[model samples]
Target: MQALKGIAASNGIAIGKLKLCVKLDDKIAKKPITDVEAEIKRVESAKEEAEAALNRIYLDALKRVGEENSMIFQIHIMMLQDDDFFDAIKDCISDEKVNAEYAVWQAAQQFSTMFAQMDDEYMRARSADVVDISKRLLSCLDPNLDSGLDSLKEEAIVAASDLMPSETVQMDKSKVLAFVTEQGSKSSHSAILARTMSIPAVVGLCDAFSSLKDGAMTIVDGSAGDVIIEPDEATLKEYEQKRDAFLQHQKDLQLLKGTKAVTKSGVEMEINANIGHPSDVEMVLENDADGIGLFRSEFLYMESDDFPTEEQQFEAYKTVLEGMKGKRVIIRTLDLGADKQVPYLNIPKEENPAMGYRAIRISLDRKELFVTQLRALVRASAFGKLAIMFPMITSVEQVKEIKELLNQVKADLKAEGVAFAPDFEIGIMIETPASVILSDLLAKEVDFFSVGTNDLTQYTLAVDRMNPQISSMYDPRHPAVLRMIQMAAENAKKAGIWIGICGESAGDTELTRFYVDIGINELSVTPGTVLELRRTVQQLD
Candidate 1:
């Protein structure tokens, strides 16, 4: 038996026959076009067809995976119409005098190459999106050509060089027992879809693809990122037992749904989910989270082409609030800047972005942008339980300034005859060391404290978490970092305000008891981890 290792993208185990995904060869020779206008028209028509196809796919994915995960298709549709991208195709057709298909391919290559060279991991992963959209355009230009993923005849493990987001979303779900890809990271859209669909997936198995024979019996342990091809009898039997145990564990976790996260001693803990978009509420509801701890308001801006208007932000917030029914949803206001940059905002790039103009700094500096968001949040408050949280706050003065802005927003709304919940709570994230040092004073200024350990650890430890050279030094469990969190918890209690953790460290089961002992009232984590955290909390003393 040949065993291969890759990055685990989802949790599950599957043993099935392997089926190689079939993809159409898109390589085409560039040919001279006699009529440039006709070529442009052909390209435009192909784009229209591609957009329509994507819209249909979007609806299908929306129904199956909810809106958040399915937003990839909507993004694909947007990318098709982007001025820079579409203009490149048109320029290639007119300037290079090439066929529509050739122009599309050329444009795809150029943009994909540019994106591949990007410093940001998210933008780099988008290189695949450029290829996916171009393939769709090619299919539109040539009716005979097609993007695969619809050819599955039976249940099997789907292996491919790489599955695009569209192909993964459109694949026959019942026939796909698991996914094995030769190239893709855990953050890839295909991997995200696999997680959303609860399909076992192992990606970035480049060397193993050479030995992956079609119809060969294979065992995929996604949780362990292991794939064994043509396993021996003993190994197969062992894996069968392992798979059974994992399935049982998952079934047992499902039983924890709708149950409170309470210890044997009857200490109730709140298990909430951190979400970036409205559609993620579906997963939150499915996981039976107590509430949304960190509603990242920046994604609504990042996902858009330009500044999202007040009404647009309001609708998005209102959607999440109403969906949660009366459960508290803490929305962090506009944490933009640093790694999360908006090109239109045109904030000058800095040498040190993490400790630079980001989060509350940008909000306070750009009062117009901050006011617009606060107005939207105030309006959304009428829909359900809403709490506003500020990030990267280092002083009481910043909190006072935020309150001033919020008070002005309320006054405007009240005078305009608009309905808003006046009882909405205010909170601040304890991310910076300065904030943790002043936690007692900061806590008194807000209704609650949510320790953002991801940043708190980075700042306190003097390590840039994104810098690979010293990422090993960035440990949230560092005694110093934990001490800071404990200090914040103590100060929150002293100020009569509740405290919680809303960071990557919140899901660390090893630290759950430590947090409980430090008087942490809540733990907010990714939606998939809610049940696991609940199980951990229930087992605690």
Candidate 2:
């Protein structure tokens, strides 16, 4: 038996034979073009074929994963039609007199290299998108290339170098039990899709391809980040029992769906979802979420090539608000900077971005961007129950400034004859220690407080959660973090405003009782954990 450790991208256990995904080697040697005009025509034909393929993928993803995720393929289609991308390939073929394949490769590399050099992690990761679309175009350029998921004859665990969002969306869920990738992170699109589909996934297995053989019996313990190849009889039996128990546990949790999240002592608690995009509302509804607690509004900006228009942002917000059907949806204003970045934003590179210009700082400094988002949220408020929340706030003055700006936005909207909710609530995320210290003062201004424990812990413990060297020091359950949450909850109560936790800790069953005891009104988490959390609340006195 050979055991390998990797990052657990999803939670589940799968016992199956391994199927190595062999990608088509589309690497074309640089060659002089016999006919420049013919090569250009071939590139155009390939572009058309790629667009058609992406459109089909978009429709399929829309049916399976909803519009938010389907937007990935649509973005690819847009990228293919982009003048810069299209012109780059044409220019390379015409200027360099290279073959169509070589020109496409060069264009992809140039763009991908630019993105890879970016300081922001999210923007740097976009290099993968350029590579993915380029691969699609190359596959179309070669008619004999078979670069698609083959039908599996038996249940198997798929092992690949990495999977693009478009590729993963098209995979057959019935035959593929799980995904084991040689390269991926928790925030990768493949990891996100695996969680959405409830598939077991182990990513960042640096030597998975080298260590495991095709058709070998494998046990994928995604929760523990273990990939066992040709497990011994005893280990296999143990894993079989574990897999069954995990599935049974999931089945049991399904019974909690649609059930009220009230404690045994009759204390009603709001169980909400933390969503990143509009399509996540489907999962929220599926898990019977009482409302949406944290709508990370940065996703709309992050996914776009440039700043999203007011109408675009309004439509995105409206979709979520309308989908919830009267359930409260709290939209947090642009929490960009740090790990998330936009090329057009032109945020200066900082040595310590976490503590630097990010979140509320950027929003306040870039008033235009902030007002545009505020305007959209306000306009969307007329569609359903919508609340605005600010992140990384440390002072009452900031709240005062934000309210003043919000007032300006409201007045502008009113003057323009735009319809919006007249009495939408405002809130702030209690993440920094300074925020916790001033919670009493801050609570007096906002209608509610949502503790973002992830950042709160990081800031309180003085540890960067993303830094592997000191990750162990970044514990959310640390006493200092708990005390800060307690402080915020107490201040909220005294101010007559509801307080909630919208962080990873909110979903922790171990902390559920602690939160209940502290008078927290709500706990918002990812959709997958909503039912389990509901069950936890129901069990609590």
Candidate 3:
């Protein structure tokens, strides 16, 4: 048996034949064009057809995936109509005097390469979007090409270099048992689509993926990121058993929805969801999460061209709060700076951005920005249970300062005859070492402690988790990081305050028992993983 490891893109297991998929061919021979206007007209016609195709795809994706995930297709439609992209194609056709196909291909390459080189991960993933739409346009120009998933007649594990959003959506999903890609990340549209589609997937297999052959028996343990090819008799039987058990395990876990996350010993832990936008509240409720643990407010800022107005922020907070139906919602105040830079904010470049002016630093420096968000949260709190948390907190002074600001917001609201929830909780994220060290003191001031382990691990280990070169060194399970978390948990307990982990680490089912043992009050993860975490807790003592 030969095995390959990759990033676990989606959860589940599959055992089937390997069916290799071919990517859409973007290579077109350049032909000198005599009629520039005619070629431009052709490009314009193809562009409209592409947009119409995307609109249809958007509706199809909306049915398969939710509105939030389906928005990517709508984004592609917008990209097709983008002035710069359209103008680039027209300019290429006019300057290079190339065929419309060649001009579209050239413009796509230029933009895709530029996006791929960007510092932001989200923008980097957009390179695929450019290529996807270009291929759609190419197909519209010529009727012969397709994304290549239409040939599958049998259920098999689909292997590809990297599946694009359009290709993944257009594929006959019923025939695909699992997906194995040579290049992709969790943030990629393909991976996100897999999760929403509930298909087993393993991506970024790189060189190991070359060994895969058509019609070969394969076992894909997506939950473990393992792909086994041509397994021997014993190994095949072992995996067959494992696959059966996993399928049964999934069915078993579904029964856990709406049930509390309680261990065998009857210790309960709140299993909440981390959401970037209000639209995600549907999935949180679908998974029956205890509440909303981390509502990343920065997405509201990141999505807007300018700062989101107080009423805009209020509506968003209100939508989520109302959606949760009185369930506890913890909103992390604007964590702008570093990787999540807003162009309008005009934050200066930093040598090491992760540790530099970010999170609470930005909030404190620009008090008005912070005040705007707090004012929105305060006004929305009256709709449902809400808890506001400050990120990148290092000292008691920051928490004290935050409370003073909160008090002023309350006073202002009162004088203006605005009713707000006074019983809402205030908390600080135990991410920095300073916060962990001073958790004993910080706990007394705050109502609770929510550990942002993603940052805590990086900060404690002095490793940039985003740097692929050193990502291996940034272990959240490292002893030092665990020690810091344990210290904070102990301190919170000592101070008689509840504590929880609202980070990527919380989604790790392997650590479910560890968290329960350490007296963690809650585990906030992706909405889809809530039941799995509940299962882990129930199985543990």
TM-score per model over all chains: 0.79, 0.75, 0.79
lDDT score for candidate 1 against the true structure? 0.85
1-541: candidate 3 lDDT, tens digit per residue:
7989999888888888998765444347789979999999998999999988898887676546644456677568757878999999999999999999888888999999998787754456567789989989988997665555745778889998888888787777688889899987664678777876788899989999889898899999888899999989999899889889988987888898778888888999999988777778988898899999998887677556799999999999999999999999999998877556656788886756677889999999999999998999999999999999999998888888999999999999999999899899988899999999888899999989999998899889987553434546868789999999999999999989999999778977877778888889998887878998888888887
Q: In model 2, what is the error at residue 218, expressed in angstroms? A: 2.4
What TM-score does candidate 2 reach? 0.75
The TM-score that candidate 1 achieves is 0.79
C-alpha RMSD of candidate 1: 4.6
> Which digits, one per residue and each the tens of the lDDT, describe model 1 over residues 122-240?
45556778899998998899855554456567899999888888888887878888999998766567887887678899998977777888889999999899989999999999989
Number of backbone collisions per candidate? 0, 0, 0
Best candidate according to lDDT:
1
C-alpha lDDT values of all predictions = 0.85, 0.84, 0.84
